[model samples]
Target: MPPAPLLLLVFNRPSLTDRLFEAIQEHTERPIYIAADGPRADRPADIEACQGVRDLVLNRVAGRDVRLRFQPSNMGLANHIPSAISWAMEHEDRLIILEDDCVPLPGFIPFADELLERYQGHPSVAQISGSNYQNGISRTPCSYYFSGIPAIWGWATWKRAWKLYDRTMPGWDALRNTPWLSSLFHDPTHAHYWRTLFDDAAHPAKGSLESWAIPWTFNLWTHHQLAVTPDSNLITNTAQSAGTNSSGTSHRNMSPATGIEFPLRHPETVSRNEEADAYAMESFYLGSHPVERFFWRLRLPLRLAPLRRILRLARRHLTHPQPGA
Candidate 1:
């Protein structure tokens, strides 16, 4: 079967865009939609970098047809991303999404395409995420499992799902006061983590900090939609210091993007994988320990501070050469 339409989100990251586009060379015949945010006037280097990204995509990327949407001014993440995806869906029923930093494995596109078709009309299935952050734990007997979390490093969704996205998170006002929000998660701690995030994202005074994904995730959870995730990760995020939202380094930063075997094994049931979801909640979403969770809750604003400190310590350890070395 032909590949699904691909939508690539890029900004001032030509080198990363070049690398990611090279990985998509195998899909030379696939039509691609490239959405690039305008360079920030404050950052002079952004002008050249953004131009390089456009040049690379137009001249070098091996695709049959290319569509470009370059913003005139910096729309930032909150505005650029959803608008771009909406633009793509205007031409196609579904499209695979990849940021400049998300490098896909050989089977990532096909894996997403298969599931997107399988669950096209299934209201419960919100998306097909190419990321699986279970830390090598086998969460399913099938090739993929279901969860409420939608990892967007590399993912795909249909028009039906995208239509449900609320840019302003309209239900926050009603949901924030009720027990409905907490009941969605397995524990109060997870609920607290998400509630804090939702509150912050929709804060009237802090409106500028609003991002698109938190609202998308909120839309999924309120509707009780689940995302189909692979048993193993298929996309490795290589953003590092160049990441738009994230910085510093950690054990989870660069997991291998291993290819999936063809002829996937499908689960007979369509229910969410509770065990895997719990693992993600504890390991990736919330902290495993109560004390750690408390600190994480406290560190939301300064989350990157701890990561920077950890990276510094790691550099020191490496440079000093431990006793064994």
Candidate 2:
């Protein structure tokens, strides 16, 4: 079957969008949907850049089956992304989604297409993610492994799964204080990290980072759903440092995009890879070792505490715990 329809989400990034669109054109002949969020009023340069991206995509897509949704006003990432996906899903049952910076490798489209069909109506599998953040570690011998953490750098999902996304995350209030989140992970720190993020996502302070993916992940978790992550990293995030919300360069951005092998090896059963999830939580999300993370929760006054002292103390205590001290 033809690959599932693809949706490209763009903003004020013409060069990145063009690069990603070229990759898509070379890979699949499926219908393409382009969604661009409008320029921010505060950024005068955004107007011209956004239009340039729109013009570039339109020019490239000549007579192909393409649909466009260019917003008149800025809806921001949290609103625009979910809204765009919802709009596209109204026409297609399933869709492969990519941001302007997420360039896919050769086999990503077909890989997603196969899994989209394979996991159709599978209650546990809510997403097919092309990005793997295992730092070259293969969690399973199978072509892909199931994860509770949904990676959205490049991904595909069905309308049924998208329907569960709620921006406000209404259910978070009831589950926040309970052990429900803790039960999902092998380490309590992982659960604690997510709980803090979900708390901020559900009840946002003014001028905070607006992330749609966090709530979407929470929605999946609340419903006990998992995402299929390929063993090989198939997508490269090209704009990690230059993007509007990015803090600085990351090692993840340096990772190369590699294609998946054909004739996928299917897993015998559907289950989340706890080891992989823990690794992701520690290395990717927290960006620290387990001992360092333990010290992070102590709420030590940074101004008074020296970094070297804290690390030295953390190493000593974490490496050797006292009995009933």
Candidate 3:
């Protein structure tokens, strides 16, 4: 089957964009839609970098069915991303989305294509994600599992799902004072972490939005939607330092990008994998909660012991010089 239409979100990062473009070319020659946020006025360097990226992408996709939405002025990430996606969804029913930093594995496009078709009619299945953060643990016996959380490192979704996305998170106002979060997450810590984040996203103090993913996830949860996560991680996020929100830090034991096997062994029933969801919540999102933070601090020394021991052994080896010398 032909691959799903792809929307490549880009900005001033030409190097990352070039790498991701090459990876996409290596995988499939599907119709490409490139959206670039214009350079920020305050950052003089952005002017040249953004133009360079636009030129590079246009030159590379010279002989293809490629579309462009290069913004004239910077919309910022929180605004640009959703708007760009909305623009793309207007043209296509289903779309595979990748950011300039999200380098996909060989199987990512094919995996997304298959799942997009399989779940096209299923309204409850909101998206297909190429990210798996289970630290090598298979959440299900099948090729993919459902989760309440949507990993957007690399993902695909239908127009139906995209239509549900509201950046303001209007539903949070009604559910904030109630037991809605608790009902969704059994663990109070996990619930609390998300509640605080949702509150912030819903009502930004400075009238500035920090993330599009938070509201996107909020929309999924409010609508009781599930995201399909592959058994293997298929997208590697290479924008640690260059990303808007990333702090150049990684999870303690997150899984790395790997290819998914063909002829997917799908789950018999479409249901959320609670255990997997909980692990992700704790490892990725809940780390900032006061209680979770305390516990993580307590465990930090223990988690570093193995690395410390390795360093000690290396020092001893260097001091003794007993092997080849």
lDDT of 2 by residue, 1-325 (tens): 5579999999988889888977887754688888999988888888898899889988988888889999997888888999999999999999999999889987898899999999989999999999887888888889999999999999999999999998889888998888898788747767766776676678766434478988999999888899999998999887553545322111233236667899999999999999988878766666445656555456343421243355556666666867875
Tens digits of per-residue lDDT, candidate 3, 7-104, equal 99999988888999889886447778899999887888888999999999988888888899999989888888899899988889999999998889
lDDT of 1 by residue, 175-280 (tens): 8878886667657666766776677566634223436888899988878899999998899887553536332223343346666787999988788887887677
Assess each prediction's global lDDT (C-alpha) against the native: 0.78, 0.81, 0.80
| Model 1 spans with C-alpha error above 4 angstroms | 61-63, 204-210, 243-254, 287-294, 297-325
> Which 10 consecutive residues of model 3 have the lowest summed lDDT?
243-252
Rank by lDDT (best first): 2, 3, 1
Per-prediction TM-score to the true structure, in the order listed:
0.85, 0.87, 0.85
Backbone clashes counted, model 2:
0
Candidate number with greatest TM-score: 2
Which stretches in model 2 have alpha-carbon errors above 4 Å? Answer: 245-254, 288-325
Scored against the true structure, residue 143 in model 3 reaches a CA lDDT of: 92
Q: Distance from true position, residue 36, model 1, in Å?
A: 0.6
Candidate 1 backbone collisions, by pair = none
Poorest lDDT segment (10 consecutive residues) of candidate 1:
245-254
